[model samples]
Target: MDYYDTIILEYHNTILDWVIADKTTPIENLSVLDKGISDHSVITLEKQKPVKRTIACRNLKGLDDRNFASDIKKEAKNIKQLDTGAMLGAFNSNLRAILDNHAHLRTRTVTHRPSAPRMNEQIKEAKQERRKAERTWRKSGLMVHRDIFKTCTFKVKKN
Candidate 1:
């Protein structure tokens, strides 16, 4: 893959941004963006890495609650204990064993997309606003647009 080391000349005319990736993961279209709002330019890159992950899912298509309860009852009858804690522990373990027997775990491979775990609806909308403001600021180069972009950036950082 061809990588572009383009720098944003408007921001101090120095390489203030970077996108580092491992040898296995090729970084494509690496460029520094001039948003005309922040002190440092934004670094953007497209890393084409097809991630395949196996996820274990329980199959409960034919599972019935009444059958599950009867199985639990049978398992409970076998557990002869005096201590309340030990009885509870045995109950939980037996419950898990019965569940596993009823609904076995099936592994399936799927492609995964990386995302920010902390990001929610509000943060996502704030980021969208920040990007829109950034585009407007870069296009018009006006103080008002820059101020709005800075406000949006601050909101995003605060979250």
Candidate 2:
């Protein structure tokens, strides 16, 4: 059996490369991933079991202090009216309502912002916009435009 597998890793014709893989090691499954680096080919390896987590939140949007307090008291009364044998039983009776009332309790939506923009992105965008406008002004070649070179310059200090 040949250990080396030659594969042409071409991406949008922009990248034309080859990857020689040593297939001696056991690989459950190999699939080309949709995401990858500029010139590198990506493959997915199925190994670990997927994990799911449940988070509790409160959806108290548009409720003032007075109304919020009243809503809470009403939910508590509803739970008490369940007449279940135990606390857990009562919770199970109105589980959906309970979860709904507490959905907005935690500020995960506001606090847990995923993949936020970096400082470099803002600086780059500003620089690009400035450069584009400068180009347009130069192409018109009508009115004398002031030098816009120093408007969007950012100096990065290395850590």
Task: Give the Å error, residue 81, model 2.
Answer: 13
Give the number of colliding residue pairs in candidate 1.
0
Candidate 2 lDDT by residue in tens digits, 1-159: 344666554656576555554444444465665455545657565543334455656555644667555665675676644445775676555555544554545533233322423445756667676677578667875444324433433322220
Question: lDDT (0-100) at residue 21 of candidate 2?
Answer: 44
TM-score of each: 0.39, 0.27
The parts of candidate 2 lying over 4 Å away from their true place are 1-16, 19-58, 73-146, 149-159
Give the C-alpha lDDT of model 1. Answer: 0.81
User: TM-score of predicted model 2?
Assistant: 0.27
The most accurate candidate by lDDT is: 1
Which residue pairs clash within candidate 1? none
